[model samples]
Target: MHDNLIVIDGLQYSNWNRAIFEQLKSGGVTMVHVTIVYHEQIRETLLRIGQWNRLFELHHDLIMPVKSTADIYLAKKLGKVGIMFGAQNCSAIEDDIAMIEIMRELNLMIMQLTYNNQSLLACGCYEAVDSGVTRFGRQVIKEMNRVGMIVDMSHSGERSTLDAIEISQRPIVISHANPSSFHAAKRNKSDEVLKALGESGGLLGFSLYPFHLKNGPDCTLDEFCDMVANTADLMGIDHIGIGTDLCQEQPISILQWMRNGRWSKEMDYGEGSKSDADWPKPLSWFKDSRDFPNITQGLQARGFHDEEVAKIMGLNWLNFLDQGLQAQKV
Candidate 1:
């Protein structure tokens, strides 16, 4: 059961409330990389970072900030969910490589090269063309590797991802991504890219967003399990893990921001029923964080052994982080 396992969620953008923390505890999550910034939210990103810091202090019993792999293990032993602060967009640093070290000191462990749009550092997957990582992006990668922060390529353009992998002194992570072979979406990685990542010692955390799945909103837990299974078959279980990408507690306003590439957009539920009233109906897949157990059950039902399930659940991620952190030291 997930109860005795080190459950680590690769990414979550929840509203960060006591209720969500309770769900994390109940779900037995040992660590979660909570994304702090996105593409359109370029403005006010620092304010949001402060908000998360305050939440970590206020919810110290339920969560603790993780600056390194050792902190993660310590938090798990102390019965707290390790909150690894991550940036979905490097826009928070604006044009300063020095800020990377400052943020690293603040316990930001993961930094996504790009969001859904192009930035000064790299082109996003949704960009009109895959321009790849820029000159500054290469320097940024080196700084991140030198400072012990993990480089994340989840929403980066394919060319940019490849560039980062080639330039990084440490292995990077596609912290939350699906295979383009299964669903040819911009958000998914191509088979060639996946193989290259595995060969480079990088890990791919399979995502669980309905839009990224081949079946779309009608996707069942079995479909999600199959996606991970197929990825494991290709990358080996050691290089695969879960990256649910659940944004359950976020408001519809945030969703619109994500879709339209703006930070503060109004909600739009075009002539349809809404689920939580706070979010649109299309977001019904994220009913609550408590649904995580269903994923574990689905994996078991699909015949994944306890050890394999444990690796997919969190150990794989932890191992990757350990390697990445050690690489930074070298």
Candidate 2:
């Protein structure tokens, strides 16, 4: 059953290598959205893409760039993983709406408006007072819609996220985050936001990052599936999919780069955890891409029909991106 499924992890950042790509194949992963730049500017963003270009060149047999929905089908047919590039912050655009189209043409198809901090476009989840979308953000969203670039609010504030959904004509996405009701984490979405996301034709890719889960690294497959069930009831099953915010084999030093990102010299541990200095221990049942099948089995055990399980696993993402990746009709 799992073998025939079209598995897609909506987000993941890892120390890329032959081993991880092999793990993705072993797990039956057909495509994955990989983070390109967290806080990089235009030139740096290009450099990061160049780095991935090297990866695709070196690992040609195992992975291919996914510029459109068709690329995903091609990857599956060829038994290679389709890699979609996404910027974790709008910094690559740097207040210029034109960069959206340029980056999308470069195959950087998704860009989050913020990354846990207020940006030129919008306020991030960690902000005390949400400014919602700025004047530039409104245009950015419109231009993103005109082009094929996706507007991702995974790290955005409540007001900002809701503002984005209202402002954008295209169906945006929270590419990686869980429900606040599931864990009450600052990074998680409120029920109000989730409801609006579903109603607005957007999608929510559930995160597997331990900090976003109820029991942290000890969160069981059953507990996680229960959260999915609840979210499905709130936001239809077609609007939900997996985005294992999996950061495997990355060094602790990279944490400072992600959170601090040249803005501050301080160690930015936003939440609780004695292991805040390091990566939280991985969930025992899903330490790597190879364990993706566990989620399929867990959903089935929780009473989801095979078809429903298929959507949450990957088809939903495929269907969403099929239309989401196309340029708007003039």
Candidate 3:
């Protein structure tokens, strides 16, 4: 069933090409918050932003750039998927707070404090010592709030996430995260963090990565929906949404590079031992962006009403964006 819903994806890192765009269109995605940074590929990040801009210009009918909630509403009206640029790592800012506004003007709507390791702003979940949000991180959060970019805490450590939530004037988002209660992975957020997020009026996009699910690599769409529904039931449906961290079409070389932590500026590829085995095995169900429909259908089969399903799919994100954009105006 084609629902005329304001569907928004919290995070996607696929290899952006015509094929993926077509698939997104087929899936009825109204807007997508796509991460442009991971670890420290500054050059690659710039190139990807240009590519997305070109896509917006070339495929104007299929996609548009989203800088605010109003843009998303316009895209929905026009039946186009709005591309909301986000950075998964502060490394893109390269220790410069001024770049935050520059990137925001370029339509980078959301930014995670760190990727999966320590940075100038915050420590990631995988760090051996959780250092929390640094002084520079406080500056970053203030600038982000001032400039109207959504503060994302998906891969940030527990301490860092809490600090961000406390300091941010605008509501932060765990753009893509799973509950530690279900999966004890370092990448998953603790129940305490989830509660704080809800209390802070932020949103949590339940991730669909297999390792974060109860069934791990063997998880089905049903399992994914149950996890999200459970999170919604606990955190309040208004604060839950979809942030499928899908990397289906990414090059295997990129995956290998990320696994080695070569993408981080702090880690030396040769000196630091590889940790490819620790990386989660990609799920069989995550074939491409087109599989988004399966998630919607699965939620329907699980007995969610149309309004609840719509909220889980995208309305929740739309509402969160509206709050952030409104904060920007104030």
Candidate 4:
């Protein structure tokens, strides 16, 4: 592991527990942005946050809440994992725009405009007709900028994601997704989106989820790193980081909650075929948090310098948070 690195995973929705926390420590991970809400409403979201509060109380020695860049440094100084919260969809806020700031006050640092379907704010990748950002989305983006919360476009459609990148004053991010050019996954972004993200000073965290990888469960470390290098050439090394999208220890049944939520009575396969209802087999080298070092090694072997490797592993995210998390001066 790169001991001096400030490793941060931009997104993960694992079935978190003490065991995973320990693995993060063993892997030298310092910060992680975790999903607090998918399609949950405000009350449900609050309950999830309450659950996390209990986790913090019970596992104080292992993890701490992070609402700012300073909190991340504090966690690193104490050798604890900083758990930052994010929402995979805008459902938590419902139809109320004011809830955006309220969610920020509650420590939600990142929020996606849509998940895999059309939302009040924007259109998701799975939608047949992507109308792009709605009027409410523009307002939400402005509010997010004012409050220093990141606008994430990870699961949004091409037009919607591009619209968000152009509309937001602050640089937005695709918190966890790959380039569609690599795998042609619906959730993966396009070259236009990637270029716009880089030109706009945004970031893209590569996903490790089988559905997003070019070769699914069989993707090699070399292939993954090569994709990283290729993406870096387009987006700049500073704008790329690891967001593994690790769903560790989660049961196969949870896929329904993630994809279908309450919106559909039937199971939503998302990008998966019928067999994808179950979690795909994890990459052999990165089956859990403890395997992060494999990526560091892979990056080095792919010809990235130590500093660049450090940036990809975590420092870039730290810099991004420093610029994106400060509440704008009134």
Positional deviation of residue 268's Cα in model 2 after best superposition, in angstroms: 1.3
> Worst lDDT window (10 residues) for model 3?
268-277
Where is model 1 more than 4 Å wrong at Cα?
40-43, 261-286
Per-residue CA lDDT of model 2 for 178-201, tens digit only, reads 999999989999999999999999
TM-score of 2: 0.98
Whole-model lDDT values for every prediction: 0.80, 0.93, 0.80, 0.92
Each candidate: RMSD to true structure?
3.6, 0.9, 3.1, 0.9
Per-model TM against the reference: 0.89, 0.98, 0.90, 0.98
- Residue lDDT tens for model 4, 85-123: 999999999999999899999999999999999999999
State the TM-score for model 1: 0.89
Cα TM-score of candidate 4: 0.98
Clashes of each: 0, 0, 0, 0
lDDT of 3 by residue, 23-113 (tens): 8888889888887777654567678788877877888878888878889889888888888888888777886888888878777778889
Error at 273, model 2, angstroms: 5.7
Candidate topping lDDT: 2
